[model samples]
Target chain A: MTVRDPKQWRLLETGLRRAAENFAIDRALLESHQAGTSPHTLRFLRFHPSALLGFHQNVEQELNLDYIRAHDIDIQRRLTGGGAIYFAPEHLGWELFLDKAVLGTADMTVIARRICEAAAAGLSSLGVDARFRPRNDIEVDGRKISGTGGAFDGDSILYQGTVLVAFDVERMLRVLRIPAEKLSDKAIASAGERVVSLQGLLGSPPALDTVRQALATAFGQAFGALFETESQLNPAELPLYEDALAEIDCNDWIYQRNRPETEAPMREAIHRCRGGTLRCGVVLDEPRQRLNQVWITGDFFAAPRRLVVDLESALRNTALVDLERNVGRFFDGYPVQMMMLGPDDFAAAIRSAVASVPEPVDG
Target chain B: MQACNGCEFIGTLYYDPEFQIWVRREQNGSLTVGMTDISQTVAGKILHVRVRRPGTRRPAGKPVATVESGKWAGPVPNYFDCVIIEGNPAVLADPPLLNADPYGAWISRVEPTLGADLALADFLTGETAFAGYCERVRNEGIQCERRTG
Candidate 1:
């Protein structure tokens, strides 16, 4: 097999667009790259206010559609898979479309890490101490600044991430179907502790151009590629983009996986332990036997308070049966001091919450 | 079974190396398909699997189902044009089965619209083909392991 020259790459800055249009371009570019009709590229994009769902996610289960509809936020599905997110115009999106061979590995985990590290480095150059968090996040002092995911076809792959240049916690809370407690004024502060934007860290967000330049330079350094600026979609992609837009910008595509909200219900549990009380809120997907989201709160003394946040991250989208293993793996690698808490306490709290879900009564 | 670095390939099933899926022809002219063990190993801890509805006609190379793991998401593309006959409810409800038992947790049952023989000809089966498949796996440095909760 022959490899494409790493020295040649394209840099595209696709300014703000609607969710449907952005997702359509995603399909077009990925398919074009796979067909060898386009060059390896790095694209920067921004979106108008939108509530985006992961490809396999149900819009009804993931977003608070009532709020979104009232607020005029576009609802669309991402080609990539991960949890849902609220994307505002202030958020900057970056993506890399490349041949998998250039990465020197086909292992998706390794590929995600490599790209995220470079993106983290880019953010670091903009003045904060950014690091790549395992799975898919970029953080500074344990608060996430970016979240990433990927989708692949044949020999090509498209990995994308969203950088929160600025954010609106209240609007996001309204747009996403998170735990209701998070909507309270007090809990809003707690939500802020989990995610930080460039504005919060730097006092003022840098210009979008500067951020884009930093990322382009970092990627160039990492892959040893010289990026040539491209202003428009390639000829092959134009036709493809139109077709994708027609298919994607419709109710059929937006509601492709609209499972009922009843399938996912919020269940809360409180566990009393020697350390303290741990409150766990689980959004359970009963049919799939999966935990869609988990929120851990209550009186617990874990030094480097990020421990709870990171633990919660580990449990996201986790299989109920793998709860212990995931918890054990997270605790084994993390070095933190808890007043009277241990790894089992954390796991037990979540398990208790899961077990508390009432059995459905047959009609 | 042909094994390489813990990856197992059952001799009776035909394999599509590109898609990394195994196809087993059923008695009723339908076929059952699942991801190869190597693919399950690479995907790691399957999180979600959504299959196309039964009766949906899909062209070759189109997604019969989409699979998501902790870090990756991609299609389980059929190797030939086919109409989905049935999707495995067991795997749909419990995705980890893909990682725990790749062979037993078949993804979909479908009827081929194209000539089955021509499609089968493109797939690898038998001991000799398995040897070649294992050799390719070795060259790619793929290590398959069974992960259970």
Candidate 2:
């Protein structure tokens, strides 16, 4: 087989598809690329109303199965890591399959930053001040607009993201097991405050073609490469895709890690410090003794506001015993000016939330 | 145990620098597999680890376990053909142990299917080999933390 120039990348626009097909293609492309049978590629995909979970996540812990079944939302597990998300045709998915050598470093964090910055730049070109928030989020003025995650096999890597072109906060809250008690107007309004969409920001959704072009342009500029559109998967990837589809499009694959919701309880607490009131929401993985994710939202004042989100990112997946140390370390190096509060206060707030839950019994 | 550039290395273990995995042969012929300290540092604090169940045979370079850090996720591949014997329950329960005490937090135990001569032939061993590992650490600009109390 004749090899294309390494500097030239393929752009595959596999428009609207179910989560199964999209993920199968993800496997096929990443495997083919790793096997040296395909060129580095960028793929754009759209999901048909799906509820997706991270590869290692427990479906029961992350989603409201009753609501998902009632609404007929397709459930699938992502090949990458992160929290669960609600995806629909209104959301645009972007992915890159490339050799790790192209990034010049084996540090995944650096690679994530570079790719997120490029994607954020693409969004910024669309007239929003999109910025790469540390640890896999793109936010415009502190409101998340895109979330990204990645997976690697040997020397090959696949990094993917979802851009909220038009998002439904209520629908997302319903699909995911956020607080059921928070289904009231106050909660929906508060949920709306945390995320932003292109349609919401621009008054109307921009053309899909325009968004694709902006992203393609940004990637080309960032990596100094030219992209050529590919109509379909390469011949070698056909069998790979078929096998992947057969393996992925099954109930077994989707519910492989079926931990109970009781193992992961969402706990919240309010702590009033000298600086301000800090409210923290924590999803504690009781069996594993870890914190899956934490959301800190309150009337806290800090000079660099992103510090709160960064701290939350640092605390993600932290062992319950190490929470205070991690929080203290997070602030030790970070230069932040909060009115009268210190890192200990943030630690205290998270600890308070965690303390509300009973410790899991030893097996 | 010996240290280089703040990264620890056990003298008796064999190292696959490319994969950043260390293998220790037990008296019972099973081998213990765990990621090197440099790897845990580079990958950041690990979030979750899921090992393939016992009795599952895998070919060389196939994943024995999947590991996820806060920002990245990937596999912990075996360097040789082997059948998994057991996964470390401690590491499975609290993944941060891989970051805090990687050597103690072995990922899995596997019995190599390859012949003894060929099984560990490619792995680096001894003091001279460990020096090379340290050189790679320096060359890669790996920053291993001096864990504070």
Candidate 3:
């Protein structure tokens, strides 16, 4: 199939909306595009303080519901795959709806990397040194600024990401069930070390329109296409949006996967080595006996602080049995200079956390 | 078993190349469904697998199971209308088994509904299945990678 119009695409800006409405539009646009009723689109969206879960994620396992309820933050599940994220009005959401054939590649990793690189280019246009990290993140100076994911149905695909324009990191820490300590100054500082916002980096947030234009220009140059801005949904997309809203704006859809929180527990362990005390916080999936996520923070003096983040990335979604081996391989490959720390220290720290809890008996 | 374009397909099972799923008829007349090697390779590593509970009736082309990877997630569609009888506990416990040996890892078992045809014209078997899969892989420009433990 040849390109319908190689140099032309639609640019859509759906202003701030409730979480369910945004997700409804997500389904409506992707489904319509898949059915060949909608044009190739680039959409910019924002949410009014929502906590979104990945499609496959269980709500109880990923969020602090009590906090979310008290704060009146809307909770909705995303159509994409990844971890949970907190969305705010100031966060600029950008998405591209295109057919896989347009990219001339069927590999998801390659496609994600291409789109993330383009987004990184857009951020760079704001005078920030942003670069694409592996998997799905755009970071500047080793601090993540944008996180991305995608959902595909048939030939159509929707790849979307959030740009932290003027984010509230403290609220994010409260809403998501992360591995860090809860609601402490130290934890908030630790979280700040990893995530950065446009306001934090630039001293003031860029206007939403400016951010959208930069992204549009970057995507246009990347795909060699011209954007025709549309302020409303295409006529073909309205009926689909209504159908999606009817199905998605309800408790049945929002709480579809409500597993018990005990199934995924945060276990912490502190290992005292000759170098220093290394503390590890691990979110373990007891049913599958796998590490859902791992975070290490300690007083150890390891040069190149980014190494810790890289190690954490390597350990994400790793099997418990393979923890040591994977950690060993990461240390072996990375060039690090530590005063008294050895690779074994990191491995032992994680193992200590795993062994802290007794294995649950099979039912 | 036969190998085509680096993907292995069981000789006895029926395959739907368009949906990228394999179906096996059990001795008890039920059918087992799983993803093909081409599907798993294109999807990358399998991180999670969720199968529909038993006693649910679904139409053809609907999801019997959903598989997620690090970057991609989608449903494993059944080619014929059926009622799900059981989900594979082994695959649910360890999803990477689907990537390690997609042929050996069945995702769900279902009993065909009344008036549903057991043998569809698109279902392929033996050498015909192998050739069709190879052609599809070529057309999609996919290179199957050997699974590691």
Candidate 4:
């Protein structure tokens, strides 16, 4: 069915909700849009302190349950794919529900880049020099401002992202098990180098309305469509949302993918490099022979400190066999200054962490 | 293996190009299913995979497995109504193996539901599989890249 108003789309503003409610809307809207009962939509959402896991992630593998329970933070799994993240009232969530035909490409990578570029444009309109980082992050001067991911069914797709308005890096560190040091001033500073908020980038946080308008307008221009603001879910979407809520609001659904913490072991290695002691903590997926995540920290001094985070991001989900080449490629293109540290030093740090594990027998 | 428009298709397996899934009928009347090279190429590097546990029953076209890549997550629909007999442990442990060896990595095994025949007209094998893949590649502008370490 062709769109009656090719130049028109709906803009949904669902104000602050609990994690389960937000995810319920995610399911209902994506399914309804795929069924052709709903129009293309750009939704703005807010959450009340929630710890969201990627759909396939295990809670124990990603979050600090004890702290989360103590703080009374809600937990829910996102329909989109990516790593886990901490959300609060200060963050703004933006989602787009459309079809593959609308994007004119079946390639998920290209689709992500296009959406992220548009989101980056919207952030830029807010006076931040935001750019789309490869894979799925929107950054300004190497510090990430927004992270995005997508979930698709048939021809329809739901792509969503978080825009940090007045972020609390310390609270995030407490919520997610990122293998970083405890929430100290130094650790917070380190976390701040990788993530930036609107309030942090600008002197003060922009109004929520202004943030929404900037993003909606930028998306409108990107898709060549006009947005008609809607405050409520359409009639066809309400029941669907309820059904989804019933399924997603319970622990059974949230913990459906529970895996043992032992499976994802944190292997730490200390490498005494010429520059400094480069310490690496790797979350190794032993059975897969893959690096689930990498964290580099030490008494090292590398100029443009964001490089460490960038290198860590580069090695995330990389195969053990590709470690050297991946690090080599990252350094080959990334311009950085270090007194005596080289790309091999980083590789060695990761290798040392991998060496902690015994070789896997053939299947 | 037969190469068609940059995609490699195993001659021994029956493929449904429209769904980008391949099925192999085992001697015990069970079918092993997995995504094809074209699907893996379009999906990019996979980070997580979850197949329906054994004893779960699903209709034809229903998802038997869900795969998540860097930016995308979606279902891997089966070609026939079946009850899952087993989920591949290796693929569950390491999803990137799907991209590394699409044909060799089976995601799940399932027995056909009652009254469902294994020989469906939609299933393509041998030369017909290559031809179907070729047509899809042309229409979809798909460029398959072999996964290399």
Q: Specify the highest-TM-score model's number.
A: 1
CAPRI classification of candidate 2? medium
Worst 10 residues of 2 chain A by lDDT: A354-363
Worst 10 residues of 3 chain A by lDDT: A354-363
Docking category for candidate 1?
medium
lDDT of 3 by residue, A197-292 (tens): 999999999999889989999999899889898988888789989999999899899888887778878888889999999888888888888898
Choose the strongest candidate by lDDT: 1
lDDT of 1 by residue, B28-121 (tens): 7788999989889878888789899999999987889999887567888677888999889999888889999999999999898875676577
lDDT for model 1 comes to: 0.87
Off by over 4 Å in 1: A1-4, A321-325, A355-363
Task: Give residue A164's error in model 3 in angstroms.
Answer: 0.4
**What ordering of candidates by lDDT runs from best to worst?**
1, 4, 2, 3
Give the lDDT of residue A128 in candidate 2.
98
Model 4 C-alpha lDDT per residue in residues A1-363, reported as the tens digit of each score: 535354678999999999999999999998888778889999999999999999888888788888899999999999999889999998999999988888888899999999999999999999999999988999999899999999998778999999999988888988987554536687678778889999999989999989999999899989898888898999989999999999999999999987766777777778997789987778877667788889887888787867898898888888898999999989999889988889999999999977875323211
Per-model TM-score, in order, reads 0.95, 0.91, 0.94, 0.93
DockQ of all models, two decimals each? 0.63, 0.54, 0.59, 0.72
Candidate 2 residue A203 Cα shift, in angstroms, is: 1.2
Error of 1 at B114 (Å): 2.3
- Predicted model with the maximum DockQ: 4
Off by over 4 Å in 4: A1-6, A180-182, A301-304, A354-363, B17-19, B115-121, B124-129
Overall local distance difference test of candidate 2: 0.85
Better of 3 and 4 by lDDT: 4
**Candidate 3: residue A130 Cα off by (Å):** 1.1
